[model samples]
Target: MEVWDRALTKRVDPIRYDAETGLKIYREDQLNLGKGGNTPLCPFDCDCCF
Candidate 1:
């Protein structure tokens, strides 16, 4: 699965997962959202607009 890394302003592929826990491993910095600011608005064409 692919997820956007908000801090890095780019996308990244998961490097590996813990087989027993099924947890994905990612860089800590890549997941942090600095200052916890306002949530980003959905794209104009997103289904939520309809």
Candidate 2:
């Protein structure tokens, strides 16, 4: 993806996860306290990720 090629400076082996398994990726403090911090990000108002 262009994001991987153009944005991140650190090399990372990206992992792909389906719906049930995808609940584990997060953008650090992207989540609130007491909640599962590893929530996946979805586009605003978009259902495509679901």
**Which candidate wins on TM-score?**
1
State the weakest 10-residue window (summed lDDT) of model 1. 41-50
lDDT for 31 in candidate 1 is: 49
Please write out the lDDT profile of model 1 over residues 1-50, one tens digit for every residue.
Answer: 66675545577766789899998887655444243434354343332211
Per-residue lDDT value at 22 in model 2:
57
Model 2: per-residue Cα lDDT over 9-29, one tens digit each:
443333444588654454322
Worst 10-residue lDDT window for candidate 2 reads 1-10
Under the 3 Å rule for N, CA and C atoms, how many clashes does model 2 have?
Answer: 0
Evaluate residue 36 in candidate 2 and report its C-alpha lDDT on the 0 to 100 scale: 34
Q: Assess each prediction's global lDDT (C-alpha) against the native.
A: 0.55, 0.35
Q: Which pairs of residues have clashing backbones in candidate 2?
A: none
